[model samples]
Target: MRAAEIRLPGVAPVVVDREVPRAGDGEVVVEVVAAPVTPLDVLCAGGKSYFGVPRTPYVPGVQGVGTVDGRLVWFPTSAGMEPGDGSMAGAAVARRSDLVELPDGVDPVLVAAAGLSAVAAHMAMTWRGELVAGEQVVVLGAGGVVGQAAVQLARLAGARRVVAAARSAEARTRAAAAGADAVVALDTSDHMELVGRFLAACDGAADLVLDPLFGVPAAAAAHTLRAGGRMVTLGASAGRTCPLDAAVLYGRSLRLLGYTNKELTGAQQGEAVGVVAGAVARGELVVAHEVVELGEVTGAWERQEAGVVRGRVVLVP
Candidate 1:
């Protein structure tokens, strides 16, 4: 098997011949069909390691869609505070418990695109955030994988309204396709006016705010929430520090939730995967994934790290 691996921190991944990983008891050996270069993967390539300091000379991918014993499957290769040699290869090994059977009839690329993003979005909204049907939601950074997935999940979960805020027109388009009731462009000339307009479009303040960007966007998102609304902080794409008025939070009876799949237990991972996989089976959610040949892995990593690409980029080994 040929696998693309990071030799060390801050180094470009190289394609090298290696043995196909063997499945241990309660594990499965998968032939990787499509593996996406995610932000996390790019981060690893940059040297700042997570999922532990890469047992050096190992694969870098954190998730992928592939075939296990001829059955379509997908799984989170990054298991905990430690990383696994993931799917940036022709074949890889994965724990059976960490894998989910891909729904029948779904394209492999789409499944690859959805990957951990869908499962994490489902977990945040349903498990950590306690989302309920008929509530209104404001999705910040609605362009990214997790953001887009949240839009679909919120809609499918029956949110009364979904407002999507994206940095570009293309992102807004994708968000709308995912079922946002309204889309707000982040580059609008009038920042506060745009914020006000977004709230108005939702028919008032939102009942829930799905936030990825912090800083100004996070602060603005707080204003969009109705009295007693909840703000779920899933990622900090924008600056980390966000200033807030204590009185405003108290007055509105607002709640702030911080969510991450890394915080979940093994059981929680299974439940979250079930929710997302079920939704995929029903055609309620779609993730845009592009599968490139293994040799194109470097270009894919560059694109993902630069944040210039739309949707997820998968590498087919």
Candidate 2:
């Protein structure tokens, strides 16, 4: 079998030949159909992510869609960022509890491409963020895969208004297409100015904020949340170390919540995946993504790391 092996932390993966994974007693070996290269995978391989790196000489994908003895499933690589191998290979091992069976005939690439990014968006809004129907929701970093998914998921989750914030013109356009009622064009720098711009776009106040971009973006979004509104931080793509205004936090009685798939029980995770997958299978939610051969994992990593590639990028092994 072939895999994108990471022999050194903080370096890119190299395509290498390796033995196929074998199913353990309570695990299933998924014949890799498609896997998405995510920021988590990159951060983990860098040995700097919260979960840290594996012992090395391991595969690096975090989630994927594949089949176990021909039954299609979506599974997470429990070994990713901790130890052992991941889904960035021709075959990967997954605990049975990690597998979520898919509806019949859905596209594996589409499901795989959604991966953890989309799941975070869906769960952050509906579960963690508790976004109420007819409420206003804001998605920071709306140009990225998670942001795009968040925008659409907010609508599907019954948010009456969805506001998307991003720095790129392309992202703004993409956000609108994804079902945002309004799109706030963000500035990469200028924290205060960015805050002002975001506040102005809100018209009044927002009910929930799905924030992936921390730093200035999170702080800015925090101020726009309506009294008692919650802002869920699922990631820190823009940068960590957000500066919260003491006045804003206390004045509005705002709540800042941290979120991750790890917080969910296995059953909760399955339910969450099922909801998102149902919407996806029904075409109620979609995001733009590019497909690449798994053989080109290094180049794909570079492109994804550069942050220039718009939409989800899937690798077919």
**Top lDDT hit:** 2
Evaluate model 1: give its TM-score. Answer: 0.92
Residue-level lDDT of model 1, residues 148-241, one tens digit each, is 8999998888889888888788888888888888888777544466557676668677888888887667776687777888888988877788
- Candidate 2 Cα outliers beyond 4 Å, as residue runs: none
Q: Candidate 2 on 1-29: residue-level lDDT in tens?
A: 98999888878889999998888899989
- Measured over all alpha carbons after superposition, the RMSD of each candidate to the real structure, in angstroms, is 2.1, 1.7
Query: TM-score per candidate, in order?
Result: 0.92, 0.94
In model 2, how many backbone clashes occur? 0
Alpha carbon lDDT of residue 64, candidate 1? Answer: 76
